[model samples]
Target: SAVISQKPSRDICQRGTSLTIQCQVDSQVTMMFWYRQQPGQSLTLIATANQGSEATYESGFVIDKFPISRPNLTFSTLTVSNMSPEDSSIYLCSVEIGLHYGYTFGSGTRLTVV
Candidate 1:
């Protein structure tokens, strides 16, 4: 299993402002994903981070709104740009350990937009 350290456990920002959340994995991983959980809602897949290449975003999510950077095998960053009140949610990063071990998630960054 890998340990994920996500920074800024929580934060409050004004509307239209941007916030960048970082995720650091203890071990190298091949599959890393970013997800968003809105209040009282299920987790929605945001994008897949590929090392040495651009991230692959899911439907309804564009790279302009949520830019992901995967600089290496163990680290990545997701930025919520021009946020609004509707964007307030818990952002989490996950890594798949394997078929048997399953996936591991970060503590999550709780963002509140005013």
Candidate 2:
């Protein structure tokens, strides 16, 4: 029911820097989620961007480190603040419509902090 478009497909930044990755959906969605994936590893859910409420972060992930905003139904943004080498990973945006429609994701933001 939706397609996602993410900005800054990849980036390399210095330590202590910050990056904001955006996700745009083709259709209205009730939910949006941010995820991170390391090389050769599975995706890790970062947080859920609520329509009218603060994002719910997963364990070991906090809002201060990865802040998210969902101002409307078809858009959301995730900011990775204070980058570090250990923060290098692929950040993704996902949206699920229904059981039949399944989930769709953006191309992803590959970030590397030196």
- In terms of TM-score, the best-performing candidate is 1
Q: Each model's TM-score?
A: 0.97, 0.97
Q: Please provide, for model 2 over 1-114, each residue's C-alpha lDDT reduced to its tens digit, 9 standing for 90 to 100.
A: 677889999999999999999999998888898999999899999999989999999999999999898999999999999999999999999999888987899999999999
Question: For model 2, what is the error of residue 12's alpha carbon versus the real structure, in angstroms, after optimal superposition?
Answer: 0.6
Question: What would the C-alpha RMSD of candidate 2 be, to one decimal place?
Answer: 0.8
Q: List the residue pairs that clash in candidate 2.
A: none
- Alpha-carbon runs more than 4 Å astray in model 1: none
**Leading candidate by lDDT:** 1
